[model samples]
Structure formats: structure tokens, C-alpha cells
Target chain A: MTDELDRDLLLEFAKAEQPLKSKEFTTNVMRETQILGNRKKRSLWLYGLVLLALCILFAGPLVKLGTMFAIGFISPLVSFENPWLATLTMPVNNIASIVVAMLIGGRFIWKKASQ
Target chain B: MNNYQETSEAGIINLARTGDPRAFEELVHRRQSIIRNLMRRLCNDVTLAEDLAQQVFLKVWQSIAQLSRVNAFDGWLKRIAINTWLQYLRKNDAMRNSLEFNDTVYVPPPGSNGSVAMDLDKALLVLPEQVRTCVVLAYHEGMSHPEISEAIELPLGTVKSHINRGAKKVTEMLAAYKQPTAGEKV
Candidate 1:
């Protein structure tokens, strides 16, 4: 006779498994839930906090710069009859937009990467 | 979660369902091993098993309010464990069709050979994710085929076939560990 068993022996083995003992398993899970369970709310508050700070820090300067920019470009175009409106249309505003976009994108990427 | 009071498991689960942190922590302590072991069998990686176990518990904590009966905790926990594993597989695209998936041969853990139980675990590792899941629920968890279908959200017939096919494959895989009849020789 060939080597064989009369029963599906895998059952006994399956039941015989001893769970791997983990130290502080409950503690670790509890810690993760506390830290991460509210991640969506936390991330929302984080972005809001960052945006609020950016607004607080740069609002005055940005407003001042914007007004100066508008006056400089529009007034010049109006008075000088400048044909280079296309050229003047973008540069500074685009830089400011790019800066804001980078701040938001950088924060997002940093948060995701860290997680 | 600080207050320590010993109570019946159902009481703790009820308190946990009501968002009582201490009760929740107690529940976690009681059930963590079962979930952890189930995850370990599912993934076959210690770290990922622990991570998935954590996710399972986290989901339990977040949705314990939705659990209708405290007595149903075991089934609820097993369902969560399976879903957590399934999500991980789907997220990683780790469980593609067998022919298209890069099959990772099971490397038997040290001191795990010879014994049928150990060999069975190695055999389980050889199965595709969905099939292995059905097999594990049936054999390891002692769940009925219909129960497995409900747990894993597969059709009844599909679950039955997966268990059948998986059981046969595992038996074949373990044939090497079979004991010899009286006159049989190496």
C-alpha cells in the first residue's frame, strides 16, 4: 500500500494552531484607532489650519501686491495703449497661483507620504 | 478607555456598542487573538497580519453601533476580518486571476514540515486568495459553506465549489506527508 491517511488530517492541524502571542496588541490597536480613526476630520482641520495661517500671514501683503499689480498693468495698458497685454497678463499672478498650489500640494503629499 | 471593571462579554460588547471606550478596550483584549490568528492565516505574513488585525478592530470600533446582537460578535468579527483581507487584496491588486497573477510559492516556515497541520498551512498558501478564504472559513473556522458565502459575499454555489476545489488541492499538496501503510517503505 502507498503512504496515505484515512482522513482529511488537515482539520486537526487547523484546530491545533496556537495564536501568535503579541505583546500590547490591544494597546497598539487602541492607539491606532485614537490616532487614525478621525483622520478625515483631522486632515480637514489640518488643511484649514494651514490655509488660515497662510491667509493670516499673507493676506495683507497679497492684497497690497494684487492692487499694485492691477494698477500697474491696467493703468499702463490704458494710458500707454500697450499691445503687450498678453505678456503682462500672467507673470506675477501666475507665480502667486503657483505658490499657493505648491503649498497645498506639498502639504497633501507630505501628509500622505508620512502616513 | 481607562476604567477597569470585569463584566460579562455581552455586557462589554453592549457598552462598546454604545461607544464606551473602556468597554471597547476590554472587548478588543478578549477578541484580539482570534482576529489576529485569522488574519495571520489569511495573509501568511506576521506584520501584515497584525496591521490587518488592527484595521479589523478599528472598523469594529467605528461601527460597533451597527452590530445588532452582542451575541453575534464572533460572526461579526470574522466578517470584518475577511472584508479587511479582501480589501487589502483588492487595493494592492494582489489577488488577480491565478494565471495572470505572479504566483508566490509557499516557503514553509521553519520546523513546519512533516506535520499535517503545518503542511496544511503551507498548502493553504498555495491557493488563490478567494479560494483560500473559503477553505479557511470552512476548515479552520468551522463555518458552513452557506455561512462562508454570506461572510465573503460570494454566491452559495461558488463558495461550495471553492471549498471543494481548495480542499482537494490542499489534500493533494499534503499527500507527501501521508503516513505509510504497514508494509509500505520509503
Candidate 2:
């Protein structure tokens, strides 16, 4: 019976609470939401720019990777071998070779003019 | 109620699910006090309660898009509130003080001071956190043991034990306040 009374007392006390009044409560929460939303958008844009920059910076290695995979489909035996020596012997064998040669030629010409 | 105020919570939640800030603001305006009060009861500190309440709403905003049951927002919000408190406990002290309940030591919480909120805070802060949460949700929020279990992700048996012992401890602590004053009762 005592336990019952105590439980009832607690319930009544809690239920009788008037709502906490604060003029700025909702405003503060909304301000935070807006701030977080803007941060999320900003970070998304930053991530996109970073990803694009990374792709550009490593375009040469990426193209070579794509070429190696493409060769696996065209001639299935390339996947089975480790033939790094073939690239030295046959430097202009594919599209990957042409891009690398063009890049190297452009850099040499640019550096020579700057000198 | 004005026509705008009469907008059903379901309608507001549906609009919020589409990432509309106005609808979300309507949600905050409507439920902030209830959430804040619940946090205050759970945490026993006014500032922490308000901050946690804001965090709960922010989480709701972030993930409400994925909330499949629009009508179950109350339970969803309660779940988030419970999670926020539990996470705070995890980071701050890992709830290591849970085992330190001194049953024999009694510190009288003075008179009721005409503020049951203050007394409730004192009464609750006496118990360890797990017990305090169960007792608060069970008695204060009127949630069932199973509901408390699901919200706190504890087993049903553990929830029942906490509420049982926690309620007993809280009642024992507050018995002084419950006593009638001189000339108040025969």
C-alpha cells in the first residue's frame, strides 16, 4: 500500500508539470538545424570538388589501369601474367601509350620554352 | 485552433519527410516542450536536458526521411531521446558510477520547497542511471516495462527489475515529502 502511494505521488507530480516556457527555445533549435543543413551542403560540395581534383591528378594512372583491364577482355592471357618488361619493349602498343607520349611531349616542350 | 495550427501532425510529418524546413519547424514548435521535459526528467540537469533535447530533434531531422512509419513519430522520438542520453552516458563516464549506490547513507533533501520538479530531480538523481531511467519512464512517462525495454534496447526482464528496484528506491527517498505537515492531517 505504501509503495502504491509513492508511485501515485510520483505520477501525479510528473503529470502536474507545467510546460517549460522559453521564448527562444524553438528559435535556438531552428537556428541549429539551419546551420547544420548549410554545413552539410557545404561539405557535399567540398567532397565533390576534392573527388574531381583527385581524378584529374591521377588521370594518367587511372587510364593505364583502364587499359590493362580492357586488354584482359580483348586478349584474355594478359590477366595471367606479370609482364612489366613488355611496356619498355613496346612503348607505343596501345591508346594508353599514345596518351602518355603526348603528355610527356607536352611537358618537355613547356619546360624547354620556360628555360 | 487556427486553420494553420489545425494542420494534423501526420501532415506535418509527411511534409517533413520531404526535407521541408517549415514543416520540420512546425514539428519542433509542437513537440519541443514535451521532449525537453522528458530530457530534464532523465538527465536531472537543466542545461544538459535542453541540449540533449535539441540533439534528439536534430537527429530526427537528419533521419526522418528514412523513418517508414510516419504515424509512429512519438515512439521514434522517444527512441532517439533514449539513445541520446545513453550515448552521453557512454562518452562522459561510461556509467561506471552505477555500482556505487549507497543504500544505508541517507541525506535528507530538505523540504519539498513547493517545487515537485526540484524534488523529482533530487529523488531521481539518487538512483543509478539504469534504474533512474526505468523508474522515470515507467512512473513519469507511464510507459510499460516492455516499452521501456524496447526503447532502451534492454531485455524485458532487466527492464522490469530496474523499474521495480528503482521505483522502490525513489519512493523510499521521497517518503519524507509525502508525509503530511503538522496541522495538515490527523
Tell me the deviation in Å of residue B17 in model 2: 1.3
C-alpha lDDT values of all predictions: 0.73, 0.76
Q: Estimate the TM-score of every prediction.
A: 0.61, 0.75
Q: What digit string (tens of lDDT, one per residue) describes model 1 on residues B77-158?
A: 8878888898898898765656211135754343333644456667777888888877777777777777777876789898
Instruction: Compute DockQ for each candidate against the true complex.
Output: 0.17, 0.19
Best by DockQ: 2
When superposed on Cα atoms, how far off is each prediction in RMSD? 12.9, 12.1
lDDT of 2 at B118: 67
Interface RMSD of each: 7.2, 4.2
